[model samples]
Target: MNAFGMNAFGMTALPTRRQLLSFAAAALAAGVLPRRAGARPLDDVVAAGRLMVAVYRDNPPFSHRKGGALVGVDVDLARAIAGRLGVGVEFMELTAGEAVSDDLRNAVWRGPVVGGGVADVMMHVPYQKEFGLRNPEAVLFGPYQREGFALARNPMRMTQPMLASLPDEPVGVEIDSIPDFYLLGAFGGRLRERLVHYMTIPEAVEALVKGDVAAVVATQSQVEAALGDRAAGFPITPVTFPGMMASSWDIGMAVKENSRDLAYAVGDAVTALLEDGTLPEIFRKHGVTHNAIPVE
Candidate 1:
């Protein structure tokens, strides 16, 4: 995992999650379709009467399966955007690839080798200038949320939000995550033995509840969603690591470069949703805190 990047896409495992942050150069798969011919324009999408939206499969609080139905913030947002556009919504669930660039190629600008065509828009893309510059084939826009790390601690065990308390109190983190690495090396490695690793943030939060760890460090949304009603006692607050590379980042949507019109239309729709309070409500419904993107 690149220390400079957070696992914004919410892949279940560390290896795949790490790959999403690299944003490195990548080649499209052999079966990927040509960009200009593959990406549908706004008029073409309207003519089809439905907007195809791509979301990462099994990404909770964002996109995931619940009661055998696909749902989450991204899913609801996609439906709302399509509704605003006067079209039906169709979802194309995506599996995380080796890098975010690969995902954009598969989800926004090109079709996967197995022949599923790209979606008109892909949700939960990292809205970073460097990333956008590296992948000119896709346009990144509509930053809906600012994602960052937070400490969710058991009040009885950890009275303070500061990392200073972690030396004696165990801290849980997703194995190989930025938080995990941060806890391992931060404070001159004094807290190494106190670090507990889990496969996911939910698991780490579970440990916090069970008294297995005094606190769990992870993305704010994951911490909030995992705690749910139990969040009443546990406090969620930000803590800075002395040498942390990226403590937070904005997340948005991506469209094919040729689909700038679609991007603009979707961005406008999101702004309307935010202004009308629908966007924050969507996040609340999923048990996640809605951290709005700062106005640029």
Candidate 2:
């Protein structure tokens, strides 16, 4: 059903600003956080009278820290959910070394021992069924959206070839990522010599900027994030790739395992948020127009 059509329960649209604030306050006092996804955490927050959420500030399109506050698509959706649950949010700004896979594992998976465990979950996290399998404690909650991927060239490089001469130039990808996997499987070792592996896209772009490679592969979202994340100036122009080859991926809430009830409740809230216009609006604001979940 369409978002408007699904709620026959006579629900009020969106959430009031005040309920959200109260929810955040209650969450912190109770000490229920992102990784604390069991019924135990939910019950704790319920007793404290609010849900506390930890959000990564100013990640753009996903979540962001703005003018001393946190806001973004994920923030909006999360806030709306908090309101539905009568919970509160406590935003946390997360700093990570590389947008690489390993760093992500270290921060989200191994972070509870440190003060970094403040928030409940991270935003803009891409989901993989395989990843969920390996990290049994983690839950992939929703298929947020699919994004555009391209092979970009350094504007100043004369060695980078045009689309017609694509095979002659090598493509650079972060090692051990889907992009690298795709290239290897598709080319059948023909272009392996031209394949360059960097630990992260920023490093791949660095190689490209130094005329070390022809193209640096990245998603549109990743590329935009890289522009701000990198120390050196931007250096990639989009090039088309095989549409069926790793064209789509998932993004969802990653929570600790055995938290089925939490996942269901959070998923239901997410479902409701998506049914409303909030989810699409957040996507549009973030330049992420691709839709993941269907309207209820």
In candidate 2, what are the lDDT values of residues 1-296, reduced to their tens digit?
Answer: 00111111111123336534643553464455345323224555556655545444444546666686666667777777777777775555555422323223333443432334433444555565655563454556766665556556655443453444445666788776555655776545566677888876657766766778767776656555544444234443445445443454556665545445665677787777777877777666654454564444
What's each prediction's TM-score? 0.89, 0.54
Candidate 1 lDDT over residue span 101-158, tens digit each:
6788788886675566789999999888877886789999999998878899888887
The backbone clash count of each candidate, in order, is: 0, 14
| Candidate 1 TM-score, true structure as reference | 0.89
Worst 10 residues of 1 by lDDT: 3-12
Query: For each candidate, C-alpha RMSD in Å?
Result: 4.0, 13.4
Tell me the RMSD of model 2 versus the true structure: 13.4
Top model number, TM-score:
1
List ranges where model 2 is wrong by over 4 Å. Answer: 1-40, 54-58, 97-118, 150-218, 222-245, 293-296
Task: Give the RMSD in angstroms, all C-alphas superposed, for model 1.
Answer: 4.0
